[model samples]
Target: MPRPVYLVDFSVYKPPDEMKMNYNQAYTLSRQWKECVDDNHEFISKVFQRSGISPTESYLPPWVNPATCKEPKYDMDSAKKEAEMVMGGAVADLLEKTGTRPDEIDILVTNCSIYCPTPSLCSLLVNKFKFRPETQTYHLGGMGCGNGVMALSLLRDLLQARPNVKALFVPAEIVTYCFYPGLQKDYMVANAIFRMGGAAILLSNQARYYSTAKYELLHNVRAHTGQDDGAYTCMGWGPDKKGVNGVYLRKDVPVQAAKALEVCLRRLAPSIITWGQYAEAARNLFERRVLGWQVPEYIPDFTKCIDHFALHAGGYAVLKGLMAAMRLPTEKMLPSFATLRDYGNTSCSTTWYVLGYMETCQGIGRGETVMQIGMGGGMKAGINVWRALREVKNVHPAWRHVAHAPVTEADLPRPINDPEAAAAAVPAGDIAAAVKASFGADFKATTAVAAH
Candidate 1:
């Protein structure tokens, strides 16, 4: 297996803190589950109660939710309007920075848990940038939050076959549309959590690109736990039989995840970690009774060896689980939480968002390693490790976050460009330009994605 060094994670982003859009607004507007809605101003306290979580036991930090916990906040109108520009612009900017041409791309894969573009994001890239028409492409949907890691796994495997393939992968979610008017606890939970997120990664086995790439794939492990009762447990707010609800975040998410990760990691280790630590975890599990001293289900000590932590800006609890399980310090893990609090959980693209921030603000020095942890249904758990390349040839201009943080691209909307960008360009929403750019000015076709 070829090592996949981290090149550049361009999508790590966080919305401004003052952005007025929040879950409270959606919850209040949602007439469906008014009775179940808890609009208390108690901040994180109310969220814990709603989530049925005990911070003490859960390992959640004090500053996470602050005074208010709401669903993710992104200017949907603005995001949709600029989605094309942001995606294309960022890609263009990345290509320009890396000294790579748009046409050099050999592979493309995209996943949008909420929005599946007609022409598919990959197609848009092909047409807009003139990537080879034969580039392998994939559009993944309905995988929920886990889609991002799944995309990485897919990209890794594809790159293996096409060693020179410059796989440009994107994983994003538009939670704005997912907000349905319902206040059922499940509905409310979805409304309370889940946020807009998107991430992009450039992968290749080419030796030239490898030198600048951040981390390589030491290994990847994926599992599905939402097989039965876990299926609908953690879901997004959409048109369920009852009504529009955000994702249904379940009570069993963490516990179920613990079991799945253990199984997956057992297969990936040996080189990543010593057998002794693994043995400690195994012994602890057997000796610790079901009711004995609370043993954190995960051992992140190995992950700790990695310099940075790029956990999906998942809700506070998920980050805490990894922290407590591995005994990680609060300060060290702040980048992810900070990204989540400010960015509002940009869904699948979260870890990328953090990666961007780290590069600019904290500085992702060369040779530093980062661990990306992802979770979704089936109590699924996916882990992807990255080591920072010696240098980031390119950093997207729109990569800044917060006010003290500069995310000025808010006003610079993305216009549709490059139609024949992907193998097939669907001509709706954002694909109009991609097809027009790649295929031709006259390329006219209705956009259709893998999922509507």
Candidate 2:
């Protein structure tokens, strides 16, 4: 049998308040896009009004500051700066929480979908934290939002292969290079939704840390439908007709996502659900196949097996579709919706934010199971099953502004264009100070680097 792996601790990065992008600021910046016509303006306005992204939720890279540069200064240097700001802040917090040093980590895995620079992010972390030269490192790129759980799946295998070791996993995305300067509605969708965020996680299989660990890795399952041409082309990053680069979102994305998820759930069901549920499902299948009954296909009661559900906060439409398909109640989806409302779509780190919301706001009890589901580009889907080993109720910095209660429909306010009204709605907090303290001088230096 494989050695058991436990989650030592995790930290979610909170962007500084100065980086906050309200609806008015985002729209104002949109107007600066070269060749943006009246139709483009109408589409952007409609998406902002209905995309379920709140006014005070998203943050942009300092390079896109309207006050300084009219056109975005997207290049290798800007991308590197963003990687440092989000990843550095989260890793600093994780080290503080786990009380672990850089050299102690036996393995390091970092994932960023679009920005794969020379001196990979893994190398960047190694240099910043002074990790040992012998540290084993892996970097994943172009895998999209599903990479959060996908990285966990990779970590679990690495831990099982090498016993008595600790692993660090950081999943993030740099939106600096993904800004679309073109007029294609499909390509411009990324500009409207993608935001800046990330998370750092520590995992260990050593027996010494098991007692203090919050959860144990139960199951890791992944599915990919890239073999189908439709799925392969649903989402991609490339230059448009004008030779402008961006990540395009085809209208077929939702349909492809559903197909990818269906393929993943088929493999995940047998591992988590009980025998009784399986027997009932088989009986229903028999009726539909051999008994000539008009019964529908069986979908086992996942709630019976899982206590917490951390679905990727892709967008409002994605969340609603998944909730309806899984037959989950509004309460089960609050964490994901709340994350989307507060942070927009942070790509690979979105599910971690959802899980943080659950741990900080709605405490997960000991022995409860958390099923994290991730779906993203490349038409990929992944699931990570975790069983809580301790009651986790501590307040996380990522959700510092949110009240420690279940988020409801009323909690998600509509997007507003008035800067003063939006700022007033945001609760006064020391989040900016907290983030600054985490990176200290490093944050300042990175911001300065991005400003040029």
Candidate 3:
């Protein structure tokens, strides 16, 4: 028999007011960037105005101050300090919530997309908390914001193979080193968002944990669109003209992400949707393929399958695209939007904040299903289906101080449709040429396979 994985408890890091950044404070900090002149500042302000992020969202690293506005120190010591601040808080809270000691964790997994030190995040936790030397530890890096669900999927598999063990998963992105002060518009956009946050989650297959567990891991589906040249470079860390390293997000990222999500949902729907919905989708596929009939695309009513959504709080455009593609109602999209508004894009940990919002505001009931979706730099989309095991009455510390303001579309910034909004110097033709040149014969065959 397979070991059933359950989420015993989870905690999200809440940065102090000292690190909070309002719209004016963000603009002030942007002025310190290398290429942020009056015009660039104005453009960035406009972008933030439409970014769906609230003015009161928190940014990170106690070192980031508008009054100082100095370039963040990206040394290893600073990185360690930032990790301690966020990860320590999250782990402490999670341990308290689960009533588990550090030594009780049989497996420890830590994910930080950009910062992986010699000791590794897992090792750091072990040293700080004094876990047993035999405890299993794994560190995941460069997997992007979707890594939280990816980590959960890995934990589920681990518990299945080794039953009756407790695991701790910490997902965070340290913004100190990732702060880009470059002239590249794409890279500078990251500076506008990408705040500091982290989440610590505890899972187990032990029978004792089941009664207190909040959710059960049901299914996880992942789709990687990196095979396509367009998806590969849509969002990634690269150097600018002046050799300043930073992450860049293409304007067409939402379009590329939608394509990837469509593929993932196609694979995921059959497992979660009702039998009737599955039959309809199967018929639609048969008609389009075997029957050679031009049939309309079949969209499963996901609301019937899942009661709550923990979509990634990536950005305004990304969330908008996902809401439209999945046919999610405004209320269903509120948690994601509200998370983005309050925390900005907390990278891998953003989905946890969304889940927290759902518990705090929407009130998920026992046995209700939730679909947690996330996308990241690998042009990867991940979905995790979870069923609530028990009704949670305790509010997470992160949501304790947050006001219960209802989210509305009006809270988000106005949408923009300028041609420049989608403009990029790296044309499609150039991307194709580069891919062909780099991969030679493999590029053509891979492109064909991806298209099929």
Candidate 4:
């Protein structure tokens, strides 16, 4: 049998307070950029308000903050600095808390969808922290948000191949350069939701660290629907009609994501499901294939085996799509919703934020399993299965603001991710009332400064 891999610990970067951009600030920044193109204040304001993001949700890069600048600075230098702050801070925190030296890491894996600079982030960190020359460095760029668990998959394989070694994985997205300065509504969604965040995680295969490890890696699977043209073209980074660059999120994204989830789950089910579920699936397969029952494929009850879920916080619809398809309850979906409400969509780092919420707020008992599911622009889905070695309730700085009062279902925006809400024009007042009901006093206080 192959040696086991363990997650030593992980750190989520909490941006400095000055970088926190409330809803109104984000709207102001978006309006400033749209003024040159298609500035319809009322329409744009409605979009921001109804985006399923609350008043206190996202953090902006220093250059993109309305409080710090008149307009966002989207140049290469600013992008690099943004990377340094989020990624550098996360890595530093991991090293400091774990007491692990830079040179001690046998492998370094970094991922950033945009803003991959020359010499690469891996080399930049190696030089900055002085990792040994022989350290194995891998950088994944433009792979989209699923790269967080994808990195975990990569690290798992590497640890299985090489024993007695440590690896540092950093997943982040630099929203600075990705800021859309154009007028296209499809492209502007990126500006409204994508936020600044990153995470540094340490993994080890050494038996000596097993006792201190949080979880033991069980299985990692990744699947893509890129074979389908719709999936492949669902999301892209390119220039619009006006020749202005941005990430275009297509309407078909939710559909394609559901398909990708189906593909990933099909591959992952056999490994994680119970023998009873396996028997049921086998019977379903026989009926569908041999008997021609025209029945739907079996979806095993994941809650039966998996104790916790750290799902992707890509968007309200994305989470809902996954929830509906998988038949999960609102209680199991709280972590992802809370992450989206607190940090917006942090892209590749979203799953880490979700996991951090569970660690800080919902304790994971020993021997319990955690399944992290993530999907991103590639129309890809990644799943990581881990079995906790010890009970974990450690507080994380990323969740500090809400850790004291755990996020309940009442805290999330309602009338969200529903077809009726999507089809009809939801009165702005109704949406505001829903938000007010959800947040209560906190919503009133936050909206005092955020409301236009």
lDDT tens digits, residue span 1-452, model 2? 88999998899999888888777766676577575677877776665555567886678887764433577778889989999999999999999888898989999999998999889999999999999988999999999888898778789889989989999999999988776768777676676677889999999999987679999999888888899998898778888888888887665566676677777788888888988998998899899999989976787778888899998876655565566567666788788888888888888899899999988888999999999988777788889999999888878888977745656777775321222122222222222222122222222111110000
Candidates, ranked, lDDT: 2, 4, 3, 1
Give the TM-score of each candidate.
Answer: 0.68, 0.89, 0.87, 0.88
lDDT for every model? Answer: 0.51, 0.77, 0.74, 0.77
Deviation (Å) of 349 in candidate 1? 0.8
Of 1 and 2, the candidate ahead on lDDT is 2
Candidate with better TM-score, 3 vs 4: 4
- Give candidate 4's TM-score: 0.88
Task: Tell me which of candidates 1 and 4 scores higher on TM-score.
Answer: 4
Error of 2 at 310 (Å): 0.5
lDDT per residue (tens digit) for residues 360-434 in model 1? 656667676677766665456678777666754334333443324532222211111112223123222222122
Model 3 vs. true fold: TM: 0.87
Number of backbone collisions per candidate: 53, 0, 0, 0
> Native-vs-model 2 lDDT?
0.77
